[model samples]
Target chain A: MSIDWQPFLLTLQLALATTLILFVIGIPLAAFLAFTRFRFKAIPEAIIGLPLVLPPSVLGFYLLLLLSPASVFGHWLDTWFNVRLLFTFWGLVAGSVIYSLPFMVQPVQAGLQSLPLSLRHASYTLGKSRWQTFIHVLLPNIKPSLITGIVLSFAHTIGEFGLVLMIGGNLPGKTQTASIAIYDEVESLNYATAHVYAAILLLFSFAILLLVYSIRKKLQGSITGL
Target chain B: MIRINITKQLRLAHENTQLSIGTTIPSNTITAIYGPSGAGKTTLLKILAGLVQPEQGAVEVNGRIWLDTARRVCLPPQQRSIGFVFQEYALFPHMTVQQNLQFAAGKNGDKSYIDKLLHLVKMEAFIHAKPSQLSGGQQQRIALIRALVRKPQLLLLDEPLSALDDAMRHELRTELYHIQQQLQITTLLVSHDISEVYTLASNLIHLEHGKVVFQGEPQQLFGAASLSSTLQLTGEVLQVIPDGAIYTVEVLTGKNIIRVTAGEHDIAKLQTGDKVCLFVKAYTIALKKMNG
Candidate 1:
């Protein structure tokens, strides 16, 4: 039986979109969580970290309810913005982003926190603004964490099954990612096709993890040399 | 002139301490904040640099209001136009020496000034080197020049030479003095080394438990003049050789190993590693060349 490339392509697209969006939003969120001091910081921290512990199906179930047309937010979006998020490619992307948020955030936050406070203070004393310091000094120094965040977010999104199942619901060419395609093949007794999908994912994940580890080793060496 | 009167509540490892200080640092002079560990010397420097906010205070540098609690005006470190060399140097590890200095220099920063500063420290050859590649002394020199790149009105050094070995420290101390003299910038130095304060600072603020116990000339504070015709020196005791009634005590003071005679009463409490104050009568002390 010939393998359909559509699911793999859709998975790549979703992973890329989710990883890009997460990268854009995650750095600032991580910086805030790492640097800011407030009375209720743990509340937001806990909320962001919920996906790490919450079952993917449970999280997906709540997300499905939140994005359904019957919900106020979904109804508001449908009426005002004319945008639908449920069972769409964008919906899958959103679900993946939420599902893999802590994967991106925790590493970046830990990296930022591990840095010396004087590095930021020194930049400030030299008349560098907060944004400049963050972009030029702080971010550059935490290269390993940034890599980990990006790679983990991408890989996690690609490997996602339960959340996509709950939200995207195997809509071929729209949201049926490789993981879902593999599940469909298994249920339909297409063991050969399922083997193809699972093998490719396993290899892809290993390569990504190997890249992260090697890059981390090199960065750590350079940092210690410094 | 920099006039500062600030109070901060510091939470240290074991207990909380209040840092209450009021002092005027004359412009174009090096003023040393002499204190024991955990006396809030570093905190005071940070306060002046706008890195640490005091509970209540006013910092007027050259008549520019840096911080005034009454008016709720606290300028951030960016607007303060001050140079601060942290104890760890705080050089950006990712950047080259040239980039670090250029970053501090800003858009209008003079390229020649960067070259000149490097030349002054004899680190021009290593301009393209990163901070990690440099030795402790080299990193410190870069840190010093980086601080001066913007031509700041106030220069704050928090134990800038504390990390160096004795020889490096001495070399850098002289280099620091020359640089400070050449620029004539108003500087606040936090140092526990008495010899450093004596050699470099014109004014001294002696802090204890985060309070200014004394503020005056280093000589005035350290010079024990109550006993007229007496010379005072602080040193660590190295050995106590008992030669009958009188004990020959060897003290390591500054770079010198001086031997003084003490009686049984003085030798009773003294040990190998005890810090002691040596008081010599003016008439009894003599100056002689090493060769002679």
Candidate 2:
């Protein structure tokens, strides 16, 4: 029994890709939640925040049902792009986005909520649109929170288990990630390889967590933080 | 012409409040809303800035109806060309002084104009400095110029000088006056600081419980007609009247009869409502401006 390096590299890529995608989508969503006020706002907030307390497998199971050909979203994507999501690498990204959305949102909501309301009002009086103000003013002010969200998302994706297992379906080299690889090693009684992969995941997640938290602390202190 | 006739129902302390403040705010002159705390002064300013909506009424500035509840024509703050200087300065802490001003200017202003604006507020030396690095006075200067760089049609200052010390306030008030004159922008200032209001406001709007109790020149409110429960009046003995402690005396150029506290001076002055000067502490006065 030997340690497989491919699974570790694959896990890194999956987490990186997931983190990047979460950033592209989550940052703007967070900006939206931070500013605009309309009727029934709490409903959308509760929906975005639902994943926080939800069971990972339940979330994965729902995604599985929703991504099937029977679902409207699934049929739309399949009709337009000829893509089947379940049991694939793309499926893992989809699951990761839902599973880790709160990790992306909570920090950002805190950042925006903590900011002085005066800045927003001042922006309004200066003749800037909500989008423009968020891009120009709110985003920069909440840099620490954004970075916190990004790094946390990356680390979280690396360490995640149930959702990825349910969605990625553990197709070796194609969809199987290091997390699954480590589990595979343990189940097959290859304790040596299991320990190796487990150690790397542990170290990687630990380092990312430390870096994110330390950077967030530095930002709080410096005030020169971007 | 800026015609503001707003009647709002606000729930300040959980009860619905009704307020009526009607004024043709003078163009290119500073109109300060002067009152005590919780007087709905800030609320009035917010309605004008489009940050707060009134239950009823409208704000017409430069012939554009910013808010009209009846017509349902409510223009957002971003659509109106007004500059608001928050009491805290509220400068974008992340951006440098220059970027703060640039953000205010939008797309039409260039770097040269920005440079000139920084120079106008005497913040050119710290143009690249972040707001966190500046002192209170310096930050205020940057905030003032940032609001001005946009060339807004109107300017709003909410306790704009309350953050600074005596010396800094003296200097900045001059700077504010100088800038407003240079830009010729109509302004509405809100401050509870009595001295600040008396020093700066060309016109005053006094509100109590969300209603306009007084609106007009500052000099008009300084006299003795509108005395409330809080302020007591003292005057030299105008008479030795038996009916109540009624003293008739001179107040700033007008003569009025007021209930007076009997003292030795009252017993010594010319009897039968004599001509003596009356003095009223500012805190005791509730005023309404007479039609000019």
Candidate 3:
């Protein structure tokens, strides 16, 4: 009769791991897409955003094939590192990162683009290296956007269902995230557990969104005080 | 010394124009680049800072080669030891005044130097204030010192005080001169304000239509008298009499005829009835008395 808390804890772990990985990869990608000019820029931009419009099942199907041990990428990983991604926790994380890529990239890239060109020019004229300028000047100036990207990516990864279901195969205590656990309860007509899982998710998501908005407000207030 | 010979094409008002500038600015002096809006003054500054590449040019600063098109050498702005105060006062909005100075001080620079610079502009109290919290004039003062914190070999200022009110502009103009003299940093200023140019520049380079119209001492280019001169008048030359190497020219002002003596080179261009502006220093103009 008691609710199994393992699914809920696993969900938070996956979300945290995916968000941290995105933070490391997203900032540089967003900077490159925001600042540089290239012939095929739109192609990569669209690919990053494909998860937003493509159905979760469709993306999950492709990732399943791509991460299967028989595939070249998956085979290389297994042979070289003795690793496997199929039906595993890391596989769920990989799925979550790809599905949440655009959520992390868009806000950060927009923030970087909106900054004044003179800021970069001034930094360069002062003899600062590109890395130094990005860290000291650009990153601090885009705090609000950085927070938005992180929050959205974390929340989106937590709420994901179809990608994890297909890639991780819904194994209990391993890939049975809160979303999948709730689905299983509903299918078996376990109304009480379903209600509990759904309520926790709704409240947690609302609290995260509220935190994001309040932080944004505080940042704006400090900007005006300056 | 800064020697520049560069050419770049610019699009102005939908017309193509070439900017060809060649000049050598002496060391330890302030040289003002005075020109109209579309005269390529800012472009020249960008080239000097290594922000813009010239199609065919060579820039030599203090015996170092910055840009040489023939040699296929062009150093990036980060490698050039120069300071540039952008027209917009490009202060980092996120950083406080002190943080801004520390950012420019670089890792090897002296951190205490920031306090000295802030003291010079009387901005010590606002060291913790962000740029957005300060007025336009205040931001400009920070921008100037931020550039100087590096002790740059060359300081390039593009209308640094243009955004300030007239009173502030006038006040900063004097402070700017004193600071330039105290540091003796080679400076290149681009401004449209004639008075500002006259007050600060030891040398003036006038640009028009992307060409150098005149390059000389400030007074010589303006045809204006020096501060030491007391009598200046616009008059018509009535006659020129030869007296050895000197010529006595008769100039008729409003009510009287004044005979001014000048060297033969000065009088050679003066013809009868030609309008001219005359400058006579107070000590040079003698007072005469008639028997009464």
Best candidate (score: TM-score):
1
A9-78: candidate 1 lDDT, tens digit per residue: 9999999999999999999999999999977999999999999899899999999999998999999989
Interface RMSD, every prediction, one decimal place: 0.9, 1.6, 1.2
Deviation in angstroms for B221 in model 3?
4.1
Give per-residue CA lDDT, model 2, range A20-94, as digits (tens): 888888877776777668678788789888877888888888888888888999899899999989888888888
* Chain B TM-scores of the candidates: 0.85, 0.75, 0.77
Look at candidate 2 and tell me the lDDT of residue B152: 82
* Over 4 Å off, model 1: A224-226, B225-292
- Please tell me what DockQ candidate 1 reaches: 0.72
Give candidate 2 misplaced runs (Cα > 4 Å).
A36-39, A68-81, A221-226, B110-116, B223-292
lDDT of each: 0.93, 0.81, 0.91
lDDT of 3 by residue, B1-292 (tens): 9999999997898677899999999988899999989999999999999888878999999999999999999999999989999889989888888889988987777878888888888999998998889988889999999999999999999989898988889988998898899899999999998889989999999998888999998888765554455677878999999988788999998758989888978887789999988765677666699674
Strongest candidate by lDDT:
1
After the best TM-score superposition of candidate 3, give how far the Cα of residue B26 lies from its true spot, in angstroms: 2.1
- Cand. 3 Cα-lDDT: 0.91
Residue B164 local lDDT, model 2? 93
Candidate 3 wrong stretches, greater than 4 Å: A224-226, B221-292
Ranking by TM-score: 1, 3, 2
